[model samples]
Target: MVLGGDFNTSRPELLAPIAQIARECDGRSYAPGDASQEVTHYTYVTAPGPAYGTYTSSKLDYLYSTDDFTGCDSWTQKADQADYRATTVPTGVSDHAPLYGYTCGGPRLSWDMHGSVDGVVADCSAYDNNGSTLGAVEWSAADGGAAVFGGTGHLATPTPPVDSRLSLSVTAWVKIAANAPTGAIAALDGSRISGFILWYEADGATWRFGMPVADADGWNVDRVIPTVPAVAGKWTHLVATYDAVSGQMALYADGALLGTAQHTSVWKAAGAFTVGRDLVNGRPNAFFHGSIRDVRLYDYPLAPAQAADPTL
Candidate 1:
């Protein structure tokens, strides 16, 4: 998607340039009308200063998206109160009004483990236009009580999201209190374990996303991302996706693509799907020493923009 705050799409000269870009990218404007009543850009015709006077409202700002954006369900432009120059007191907050687009059809499992003071189980608010219980996970509080897990504080769902027939994507928000030598973020382990983990080398200065692949040698295939700077004490959003159709695996950190590799293995998780630790041979290992929240899983690979947009 491409967005402009002060694009001035009302004029042919300015709109021509944006139109060229939209054509090259195969995108369309959010509002496809040519009327000043659809105006987002407001101005004053009788203001005190020359710079602020002799101007009429016009639709200037725009949002354009590609053809693959199939879930654009609605668009709303703020038309009242602070959105316009007339309704605001002492003018307005900005020359342009706010615009919003709503979408649907994402996330097979969403665990917004919030609103809990302290608990041993994290509830899964699991829904995907269709609803079912992914089940609550068992998690013990870590020592010092900041949600750190040192091989002890782990969680598991009775039903796993892994299936050999579907593509997969996982996303999480994590805050690392102190860097671990190595850690597990989430895993689906049974007789043969396969999942996303992180290895922090260089004495906690760097970290990498590790995906253990199931192979003939029994989980010997390891795909590792290049080490990145470990920013401790800050929240970072991580996204990892595996496309069964494309045979591609990608890892992202803080909305930026880190690396990609081919992964053709079919995932059939039976033992348990877990978080905060990895289960190898049906035991917890590589426990994460951090706080995890907003962990989501999907049956389809997410677009890079969707994965990166935290609001979605």
Candidate 2:
């Protein structure tokens, strides 16, 4: 669930209700970085507009959610950093800069290493989200980071049987090791066919997001995002979505739109979903040799605005 608006979050009387609902629902605020009671809003400057005469800074807007579906841990306040804007002066967008968040964990699958023990990939979703270890994997690391394909590492689960007629969106945060250039982060494949895949290209610098429906001559649609200097050894968030109605596919990095294309074929792979690897030629190859975290899948295209936010 999500709740937001100009709640005058700075006021103790108003913050009371916000805190009450969030605590009761395990929710968190999107702005101000954390669940702390402190509020940060209202831009103050000696200019003309809303804050020209007030000469006070106050936080009047807020957003809260019960689900960690957006994959965003903290909100970056533009007002906090003086150098946030290099040369261009702040435009009068409003008294507030845009509050950003990413579109994450839909009604489908969601997983992370948050609550894992020794070497388990705990499914935090409310329904059939547990994954069976395929080959071997290691989880002895920091929070939300797990190593895959040491020798052979992967995770698999029975297909959730979501209706193919619906749209699709998949997102994952991964860090690829130098040794392992090309690897797959996730794929949905059947006995001999595949539905969709989120993997790194052979170049190891670009990520390939593809959906190959059974009826398509080739991949119904594919998007390659160039991420070289910014990808290696760094945790990069990748998001790909397909709009069934519009037949459009879009790919994003971090929270920025990279590119988009069109796809018209329907999905038909009623098989298993695999993470940390992809099935090639009926075999699990393209094994990911890095840390994977915050895997999410949605059954619908994310709103364009939400996709732009790093913490939705």
Candidate 3:
């Protein structure tokens, strides 16, 4: 159901065979940031020995799938990642960057966090629901100007991002304070409780993504705490996903699935969406103490491949 390789040509005429197959067999091409054409750049240089020779600048690699998929990601960022990086051709790992997508639904919201922090933080997604800063959150130069949370600062949207009753996925680039003990990364607030909370637990020094079964709950939380311990002073790409249909949740760190657990007890937490902070028992708690950037929210759960991107 999947086809992939370097065709050595970017011309439309030469790729007609794959296009014809797509039309005849209900398949479609999957380019990293586009849906209509193959667009992985040809970064190969015909020279050697630290030569900045003329580099090819056209699409030369491609992938097509007969199975339905949602969001696409390019291997163009880090040594590893839980989500796609903003740039292409990550640290010259290869002459041509890899292109791949996941079997999930379309994205609903995102914040690149590369905008001004003095004014309203713009939402990069199509929703147009801008964000505002809470407390004394300042901007850091990391990841093209990320929001730095100092125990009690964060970014908040006017309304909730998604209905927690449905399947959902969230990604964020986080680097905890070297001296800080623990903190929360992201959440959707509610009057009585937050929908879900992805935070750092100091007990095991692990990343815990927790979801309560009901709105008015006890201590019943299906928490997916990965076995890997978090490292401070460096950015960690974290992704947490919940598939409502399967009643399962997964957590990924640095482009790898760490763990999964059953968590079907879902409730819609209706309130403003907040980053770098979490709301527990209808109150403010677990203020993140670090820098957060490139926060994204998807309305659908991401598959294992869409998350374990090797390019970071």
Instruction: Judging by TM-score against the true structure, name the best candidate.
Output: 3
- lDDT (C-alpha) at residue 301 in model 3: 75
Order of candidate numbers by TM-score, starting with the best: 3, 2, 1
> For every model in order, what is the number of clashing pairs?
0, 10, 2
Candidate 2 lDDT score at position 189:
72
Best by lDDT: 3
Can you write out model 1's per-residue Cα lDDT over 163-282, one digit (the tens) per residue? 533466777776665645466766665554545444334353554554555512244544645557768767777787766656677777778887777755554555556667665654
Each prediction's RMSD over C-alphas, in Å, is 15.0, 16.5, 17.3
lDDT of 3 by residue, 1-312 (tens): 677766787775676776666421112423222334434564544455563444445566666666555445445442222212243434555556676665543456778777654668888777776888878788877567788888877778888878887778888888888766668898888776678888988777888898877666345678897889888888888889887766788999988888999886667888888887777666777888888888888877776776765222
All candidates' TM-scores?
A: 0.55, 0.60, 0.66
As for lDDT, the candidate ahead, 1 or 3, is 3
Q: Which ten residues in a row have the lowest lDDT in candidate 2?
A: 24-33
lDDT of 2: 0.61
The 0-to-1 C-alpha lDDT of every candidate, in the order given, reads 0.54, 0.61, 0.72
Query: What TM-score does model 1 achieve against the real structure?
Result: 0.55
- For candidate 1, the lDDT comes to 0.54
TM-score of 3: 0.66
Across residues 90-161, which tens digit of lDDT does each residue of candidate 2 receive? 434445534444444544777864534444556666666677776777664575455555637788776653
Error of 2 at 165 (Å): 4.3
